[model samples]
Target: MTDSKLKVALVGCGQIADAHLGEIRRILCARAVAVCDQYLDLAKQAAARFGVPGVFTDLGKMLAEVRPDVLHVATPPHTHRPLALQALAAGVHVYVEKPFTVDVTEAEDVLAAAVAAKRLVCVGHDQLYDPAWQECRDLYQRGELGEVVHVDAVLGYDLAGPYGRVTASDPDHWVHRLPGKFFHNTIAHALYKITDFLRDEEPRIFATWFGALPGTDCPTELRVFLQGADVTANLLSSSAIEPSQRVTRVYGTRRVVEVDLDGRLLRQARAPTLRGPLVKLELPWRQKREAARSLRRNLWHFLRSRLHYFTGMHRLFTEFYQAIRTHGEPPIPYAEIRRLMAMMDQIFRSCRANERLSALANEERRLNGQPVPISPLDPPLTTHHSPLTNP
Candidate 1:
């Protein structure tokens, strides 16, 4: 829409804002013109950090004055809906953080607003843009990995960290207020990575929740099984565990590829021979060659420091910016966003229903004088939680 350079404005000054600032600075077609936040000092700090000349404590004021071509809604998930709607209403394209809204209805509303305003909205589902993830996608697309059989997307968290501690201690925190709570804020990272490979309109879910740290009300340990028509996906987010990593392992009919997102590594495993012990000898070499290639690529990124950390964000932002500048289709389509939100809403609702059903089954057994046993509907314990299916 812009023949000239795009003026990008960011509306959050938190940690993720730094990533947006970096990429906005790097993109030749766009520049950070202003930043806004409720905290004036945070806005000032980001403005100073990014050399953004305009800063505002109010988003409305910033929109009225600078009228940025694109706005990044990096605020908390709860604030995403209103802020995004506001940006669309003002005829500004929006890029919002993951879990684009707290729930499906809000996501739909934002999409509708974007349509009405003739603007675009891109979710910060940036992980799939990471180099390693992109390579994995390419492999699948080219049929080098064969048909995707299953997907396992895992994310680990450190509960002692600032975010965890803050949410754990504050009952009134925006995270706790979310319909899906902490999981809502994060499930997108795990789900969006592999959902495209799934063919089903609505995947059935089996979920499990437990607190790794006893006496804590927050369910730090969680897992979900997503059953697709052709490919199944396992989504894991465990704050109770350590060795924090973001990884997605894709199983294919002919081979399996492991996409280590945090490590920025990709490995392919395949039948190295038509027959016999030769494959035993050939497979390791094949894996080693792939790993080494990935290492070289990652090393190149590492030499750059800050860019290495925000590589995916940078790529995602660049593509979105280019599409806007060229009047091309949005980088991620609105229908995809709708499908993603629907999947998430179903996951949250189905899991809660599972919990309630489990409780009810227990009560039923006690009243009927039958021996109490674990309900089949109840999530079974494993590295995975139970499936949360819609009744």
Candidate 2:
């Protein structure tokens, strides 16, 4: 809450840090004054590359020296909690990366810290602010999509992508050690988009695993079915034949809106207005018109990307900084973060239980000298309508 420009410091100098720094630069009221990493060289490199004036190996020392108004925690999921708590305790606002913390309990702890410090905290559920995703939300809010009857968030990955291939080859990669493994690192991007529309508290989740490429370092494929009070959602993560994909679709009683995030496409499909046999004659033109309009909007966004690539992130940070300065609500509430972590905990537990059951069945087959077939395990949990809103 300073009248002058807010001084910001970033603690993690990873790949995502580049986006954070870029967005911070775009904020006229804030500047990234210092950068810190445990490895001094990494910090120095980031400082040099980004022209950050101050670099320090020790977080506490850096905090004492500059005392920036906000600290961005861009480290791995495992390090988020401790680092965030440290910043909160020092009376500094914090903007954390997603999956907020590794688990529900830890997320609650961070929330408690924010409460005690009387500061604001926000998570990096940046997809909710993405232009395409927000456009879909707007349609639903405007009642164009009607009540959300069902939601689908699909994430497609290439096991051979540069980062994916590196993680797959290195069993000791930090990603493999996460509680939910590959799913934890990627599933948040899927769940938050659907959760944005779901207001039900106590949602029931049943998950199934498909080891499409079994030899990968971690489970690279998963499907979770979630049922809420009145809305149902499916979260799918898989290493499919496609190179990559990130899409979220909302189905309503009136129309359906599908957003291809990676492709920057948003399309809506509805039943044709014409009736009788003549309906077929007019439907094709209407469909083509819809497709053409979507392409036009997506292409506009693509051209704008040349100026600012992380537009969603830039918007998120700008709103977050405004909250800190004016003492308003955070861009994303803590209660939402709590609910998200609870859902992740459920997914991890269910997936682990499924894995254990499969192992037992495989052992039984070996004991009987029978062949074990490659197939997905039967989902052990049931999905039911429970309007319990935990957040």
Candidate 3:
């Protein structure tokens, strides 16, 4: 291992590239030596903003000249595999953003190339490493949550937000071209949170896709049900939900742990010991106390300049650099990466099947002079009085 600080380079100067640049600056052991993008102006702008020394329009040139120890691939999903393979071939470790590849096959190819090059690669499942999620993980690992009974992972998207607004308007946006469309690009942040409890490699998945927002043809809402060996999980990715959030609630025999990724808060709810009315009163007070504690903790972190929105990204980069220096395993295991990709493949397949069957059923109803069934997208998931509502 080199005694000098690790040199990092980033490719794809999009919105996520800014995140990588900002977080890399926070890691004392690493520095952004170079930035690259197809658009020379974007690369130059990022380098200037981040105080990066090297800027390039060509990735090969950057790899040859700057020779960074790590490369952050912040490009679109389809470009991840090739860019990563190129970096690995040049003896550079890779840190890719979520939806590591378009599909499982591409994921395997990149991982295999990394093994052949004797380098390491990590996917940017940042939400799983958030501080609140870390606390939830610790509780589950220490058996404080007991055996997991069920899990709910919710990722709310705001169509009116900066990125969403652009994607909704741009027909040629990269996200629209992906196989699963927006779901492929974003649902990973939600699904990865539940993978810890639903460890079955080949879980039964039932997924439905629908358009919740009035936008392009692509669906804006996704509902997925996964049944693993002993645990079952539900994942919701909705752009219609108000005040969008990224939350995961794990229900165990002994307790319930909810990690609010947006607010960076962790709360636990336990079965009431008191009988009848007292139990209801005590529960609300206990929840209030937990919320207050979370508020104070976040305030302390904020004072220390550690409560930034991308703190999870900063922590992940720090750990990955440490792993590279020590030749240790990455923060996320390769098996987990493959597992996630495989699950996505199955879920997307189910979504397609659902669409096909819906079309057939609707046609049959029309021929019989009956009213057409409502598509899943016709109404928001929130309006449905289903068991999926958080307990």
Candidate 4:
């Protein structure tokens, strides 16, 4: 709460730390003052890359010496809780990366610590602040999208992608140790968007998971159905799908809004009023117009250098810093964060239940001298993996 630029420190100099550092530099009200990592060399490397003035190998040393106003916890999911609690206790605001904690219980603890310390905390649900999503939210708020009825959130993964390949090959990765396994690290991206639109306090969740990859226990595919008071939602995360997509489509009583997160595009589809041949002739024309509009908008953004892959992260950082300066509500509410974590807990619980049932069925089949189906929940299939940090 300084009138001058805020001093920022980052812990966990992992892959995601680079993004956080870069975005912090973009915020005029904040600057990266120091960085810390368990490994000294990694800390030095991040400081050198980001031009951060201070570097340390220990969290306590960095906190006491640099005394930053805000701390970014980009560490592994399992480490998030302890690291965040430590920062909050030191009177530092915190911005934790996605999947805030391994589960809801740890998340609650971190929030409680923030309250006790009279500090603010924010989670990295950056996609919700992306341009396309912002537009969708505006439309919904303005009654352009009408009454919300259902939502479909889909995230596609590539098994051979940079981070994916590392987790697939390294059996000892920290992500593998999370309670929800790999899904815990990535599902928050899809769930947060659903929770934004479906406001029911106690939503009912039904989840199914499968290991699409023959040799992996990672459960590469997940499907979840959620029922709110008046809105229903479906979430999907799949590695088998080609042309990897990140999209959320919200269906309302009057129209549908599709947010193409990867492409940074938003589209609206309204109920057709034209009849017979006119309806057929009009829809394609409308689609073509939307396509052309998207092209122009994207081209403009590209020329202006605004179409960045991390635009959402930039916006979230700016808003969080503003909240710190103004003592205003955070960009993403605490209640929403808690609700999303609870939803994730329910999803993973269902996955674990399915595993138990599958095991019992296989055991019964063995007693009957029949061939037992391979269980996707078998050992060595890998569990949790993080897109942010390995440490």
* Selected candidate, larger TM-score, 2 vs 4: 4
Local error of candidate 3 at 200, Å? 0.1
Clashing pairs in 3: none
Q: Across residues 1-391, which tens digit of lDDT does each residue of candidate 4 receive?
A: 5579999999999888989998888888999999999999999999999899999989988999999999999988999999999899899999999989888899899989988898999999999888889989999999998999999999998879987888777767777777777788898998889988899877877676887333446677888888888999999998889987899999988789999988787788987889998999888888888778888988999999877888899999999989999998888888888988888888887676666666666676688796776655343212332111111
RMSD of each: 3.5, 3.6, 4.3, 5.5
Model 3, range 318-372, lDDT digits (tens) per residue?
8899999999999999999999999998888888776766666667668879787
* lDDT values for all models: 0.82, 0.83, 0.88, 0.86
Higher-scoring candidate on lDDT, 1 or 3:
3
Q: Model 4 reaches what TM-score against the true structure? A: 0.92
Which one wins on TM-score?
Answer: 3
TM-score of each: 0.90, 0.91, 0.95, 0.92
Worst 10 contiguous positions by lDDT, candidate 2 = 380-389
Shift of residue 7 alpha carbon in model 3, Å: 0.8
Tens-digit lDDT string for candidate 1 (294-319): 77876776686643767888899999
Candidate 3 local Cα displacement, residue 191, angstroms: 0.6
